[model samples]
Target: MACYTKVEKETCIACGTCGAIAPEVFEYDDSGFSQSVLDNNKGVQAVPEEVAEDVEEAYEGCPSGSIKLNDTPFKPKTPVSS
Candidate 1:
C-alpha cells in the first residue's frame, strides 16, 4: 500500500497547512508554498507510511486545493551509483 501525493505548485497558496500536519512528508519551498520533501517529482512524491494519515489530514485541510492524494502505486527513481 502506497500513498502517492502531489502538490499543484502553480496554484499553491503556501498556506503551510500540509507542512504543519506532516512536516516529514511536506515542506515549504523558497516561495513558502507547500511541496513534497522528495524533489524532481513534478509535485509527485510518496508519503511515508508513518505519515500517511498526516498527509491525508493536510490534504483535507488544504484550502487552496493544491494537495492531491492518491493510493496508486508510486515508483520513485532509483538513485544512480556514484
Candidate 2:
C-alpha cells in the first residue's frame, strides 16, 4: 500500500523534530514551521518505500503530533450499480 505524509500547519509548533528525524522528507518552512518537502512544494508528500520507516519515526517523534501517514488514496468514488 502507498502512503503519504503531512503536517498540520495549524497545530505545528516549529520544533524541528520532524526535520531532525527525517530531513529528506521534512524541512523548515520560510516561517520556521515544519513542512513536507515533496510533490513540488506541496506539503503532502508520498512516503517512499525505503523511507517509510523514517517517516514513521518522524511521525512518532513529532512533539505537536502534527505529522501523519495517510495510507488511503484520495479519489472520488463512483456510484455502485445495483
Candidate 3:
C-alpha cells in the first residue's frame, strides 16, 4: 500500500488553496479542512508533479502560512542571493 495522509487541521487555515490547486488530490472535509484523497493501492496514487507544485505553492502562499501538505516529499531549496 502507498502512503497517504492529509493536511494537519491545526495547521490549516482553510484557505481552500489545496482544493483550488488540486481538487482531485484534496477536498474539504466535514470541518472544512483540507483532506487528502489519494488512495494507495500498491503504491500511493501520486499527485502529478504540477499538482504537487501547486500544493506547495498553496502552502507557501497561505496568508497564515498554516497549510500543510502531507505525504509529499519536500526538500528545502537552497537560498539564492539576489
Best by TM-score: 2
Q: lDDT tens string, model 1, 3-73?
A: 78878788898877888888887888777777787643353556678888888899999998988877774
Ranking by TM-score: 2, 1, 3
Candidate 1, residue 60: lDDT: 94
Clash number by candidate, in order: 0, 0, 0
Say which prediction, candidate 1 or candidate 2, comes out ahead on TM-score: 2
Considering summed lDDT, which 10 consecutive residues are worst modelled in model 3? 38-47
* lDDT tens readout by residue for model 3, 1-82: 1223346667777878777876767777788777666642112355566566766666666676655454744343378999
Taken over the whole model, the C-alpha lDDT of each candidate is: 0.77, 0.76, 0.60
Clashing pairs for predicted structure model 2, backbone only:
none
> In terms of lDDT, which candidate is stronger, 2 or 3?
2
Better of 1 and 2 by lDDT: 1
Candidate 1 collision pairs: none
Q: Please give the TM-score that candidate 2 achieves against the real structure.
A: 0.77
State the lDDT of candidate 2 residue by residue for 1-82, as single tens digits.
6788777778899888888888888897888778778752343456778878888999988888988677863343378999
RMSD for all candidates, in order, please: 6.2, 6.2, 9.9
Count steric clashes of candidate 2.
0
Query: What's the best-to-worst order under lDDT?
Result: 1, 2, 3
